[model samples]
Target: KEKVQAETFIKLVLLYNYRVERIKQFTNVTMGASTKEADIIVYNDDTCTKPHIVIECKNETISELEFLQAINQASAYAYALSGTIKYIWITTKSKNEYFLIDKDNNIKQSIPDIPQFGINKIQKYKYVYGGREQNQEAKKDKIKQQFFELETISEKDLINRFKQAHNSLWEGGKLDPSEAFDELDKLIFCKIWDEKIPRQKGEPYNFQIFKEPLPKNATKEQLLDIENKQTNDLFNRIITLYNQGKKEDPEVFKDNIRLSPQKVKTVVTYLESINLNITDLDSKGKAFETFMGSYFRGDFGQFFTPRNIVKFIVNSLPIDYKDKVLDTSCGSGGFLLYALNKIRLKADVFYKKDEIKHYKYWHDFASNNLFGIEISEKIARTAKMNMILHEAGHTNVISSDGLLQDIEIQKNSGNKEFKYNHFDYIITNPPFGSNVKQSEKPYLENYILGHKNINWLDPSKNECRDNQSTEILFIEQCYNFLKVGGILAIVLPDGILTNSSLQYVRNNIENWFRIIAIVSMPQTAFSPTGAGVKSSVMFLRKWNIQTTDKYKLIKQTLQEQIKKESCLKRKNRVSARSIEQPYPRDAFSN
Candidate 1:
């Protein structure tokens, strides 16, 4: 609502040439038995003796029905101040209606604009570029001009716009909710690309609608042709921009925009005038996250890790700009984004006076240090989009099972960054309660946790199990991704910590890593996102080669001692049985 009010205020000052002092905000008017506040009231004089125009504003997200109600409300205000008020304007940021109040006739007539100061006749259009004057009287008054540039908005406003645009696409049931989300993502990408394009001051953006003055005597067919041509031109321009972005980062999207030209225009209308590139990064990130969380929590909730948990885990780690980070199950890239933001905050402190340096410091880290792997292709793309919305760090995120071998991950994702023992830190909240069957995912056989019998003395002797829980495999997968002595902060179910049956799994963790800390989380921690299992975040450091070798030798010695003890017990038992059988045979002979 503030966005609408600010926009209306600007248009009144710059376009209509309204004197700032003559315009009053939140002016109260007497109703039947009480009073109500008008959003904006313009007076004919600086003393505010006579009201000239009364304006009512609503948020851009207001429904059409609600907007009409606002118009009626504005008309009531006009009647309350009947004799003096000449106009009633109802507006949202994207839609507007102007009226000329015929107080004597008790009628309200639609108009293109309320007349400007010292003008008796209203113009056909409030704004025109490079056009002849509409009338001789209008020529006497100087026309005030303003240009549209992409503007930054608050987080609440941004989220509202996102929700409003997304609803406009799917509310008619033309496209399913998921398809609408994909189309919206594509259009938002195009909008951001359009904003980054170089342009001179006062130059219009191609992403917005351009009104062309048509001839008065034009045929109906000509008008239809012009409208179709305009839509086609806009669609072509948007596609060109989208293709350009895809050319730069081929992995961001794998499909062209599937929305019709009209649908595409609908999305563009919601996004074109906002400058996402210049918006505060934290605001942008949170806005996208809040919007995305609501959608995914209903459809792909298992892939989402609550933001509070993500922030908690990330904050507890000693991550730095120089550290190479990975989220094995990077669902929507929440952990990676938090890590990136952590580094960005550091950049702010280190490069306090230099804006370019500040951007470069964090941007370099995001481009070079962050990596992720997600099994679901759709969720992986969502993760990539999330990263892009946060400004960068998406190039290394790939769509592949986190448990896949490094070579297989590389082959599947076409990104060579998924190397064993390479990342400096691994942070993830792998999906819990899902069993990965060895038959279904052949890669599971390669994980020690996937084995039914694990031979700690010699890993090669381990027999592969038919199935294993995904969270267990993720523990080992995160270990594989981290370098020796590197950190792993993973969310795991409480069963892994206390279940006697998973002792071997615990033993494997002991052999491979040095336990740092285990922070138990409440069962309800993830309830809001649809996860209800009891969980904890375990922080571990991968053992160095020397420590791992020492553990292997210790296990070997223990296995040898156990074998020797078993042989001794068998020999003693045989001797005792033979002695007892000899005495029985002598008695039988007697």
Candidate 2:
């Protein structure tokens, strides 16, 4: 992505006032545990947490699949960044070519309200302005005057028409075609939105991946209906394809079908990835980018933060001086960074530390206090770059799972290392699925599910044998590391929160963590993930002793909620209260 160069240009504008750390991009590996590498990762050396200017290069006409592709990459960056970039500016070749990447995944994005592409009208006017192509004087003075007038009359109601033109001249305007483009860029950039659109004004369309998501507060029958509809759609498509048999161009057949739910969606998503078509400035550049995946990574990062949501998460939580923050499954490190900023700001406001002193300590303390673990190395790398923006390289983010260390040893007479003490605070959006499994390890002791200090895990149970489900173990592990009084606010699959099958797990954890609140999230909150696994923000605090009471608390709450639930009331319920109390390791509940 041109973001590396784009950031460099931005850094240049900031100059010595702000320092740029790295140039290569970064990414996390998604297998086993997360790992990291970089393409262009830069850390800002200055005290500032965000870039003075955020530049998102724009694309011209784009296809639907490309929009989805853009969402995936941009959402990842947005997920990874809690505080870094601000408002988005997509740089494109023409006036009608700008679009902001909505990092927040808000379905209701405010699109450009006006038709700015109208200024393409001035392209021909400039050609005849000067006889010679390189006449700088005649080009600037005259064309600039035209740009000044044309900008207002064109597509957008620019906030600063003169400023846009002046900045166009700032770079001396591309020298390729002197008079023609001297100040043409001003109009092109200022009127930065591509008006040539697809999805005819009112043309009906389904996302192809999904038309309507299972609605909020859906009935059990409604959920079942939604599921059945999807299953049928996929099954019908598969039957059609199977009956037709395979062909040279399998995806193109008019009657081609996909049978399985996974297969259909897989086919659609991959096709979308491959067929993401977007017209950028030069055709070659656009082609090369799609060929290299710049379309997704670049266009996605262009969207700025979902301001309201970020504020809500950051504002809702109140932090104190001694709290140690950890963000497991940290995507772009947005929450961690925002939390750090909040603490720094609050401390400065009340702690009596002078502005300069507090500023220095925030820069130093934030780098050390915030730790992140990301599952995707690519995303992790993005996270590191993001942390660097806040000048926080010392946060000790691991490319591996935060819940488990691949290489760790106990030192006898062990004084509790900060690493061993429970985290003071943990806020994260862990992967949602029983489908995520641990990477290949020599062995996992059955005892961990039961005993500890075994140095191995037995994969005997169906869940273990498949090793397809990875998240439950980490959920268990997050409980393990937190200190008795530490706070944890996390996003999890609702199933984990209330499922009776998890009673055993809950029994062990109830004493250690107390449920505080749960913020029901909308399905589209992470439209790109598309799983919509009934997610919720569950907050808790680790406690000591009193495991039974905690277990009771958890059970009673589940039962209470279940009573109010109209759908699952009659369905077979997992008995939280069995004939005899359940033991840890014997059952899984949390």
**Highest-scoring model, lDDT:** 1
Question: Given candidate 2, what's the lDDT at residue 347?
Answer: 61
Clashes of 2: 59
| Distance from true location, Cα of 497 in model 2, Å | 2.9
Candidate 2 vs. true structure, TM-score: 0.40
| Regions of model 1 farther than 4 Å from truth | 1-11, 19-56, 59-61, 64-90, 94-144, 172-174, 217-229, 353-355, 454-462, 559-590
TM-score list, all predictions = 0.79, 0.40
lDDT of 1 by residue, 1-590 (tens): 87789889887887567899999888888778889988998999879979999999998878645876998988888888744888998977755667777676666655545666656655433322212233333446556323334568889878877887888788757678877877888888888777777765444566765544344455556666766765677788899999998998788888898988977766766776677888988898899999888888877888888999999999999898999999888989999999998998898788873588898899999999999888887788888888888988788998887888999889888888889989999998888889998789999888878887466655567688888998999888888888998999999999999999998889889899999999999979989888788999999999987898899789878988988999999999999998877665467684
Q: Report the Cα RMSD per candidate.
A: 6.3, 26.8
Scored against the true structure, residue 170 in model 2 reaches a CA lDDT of 32
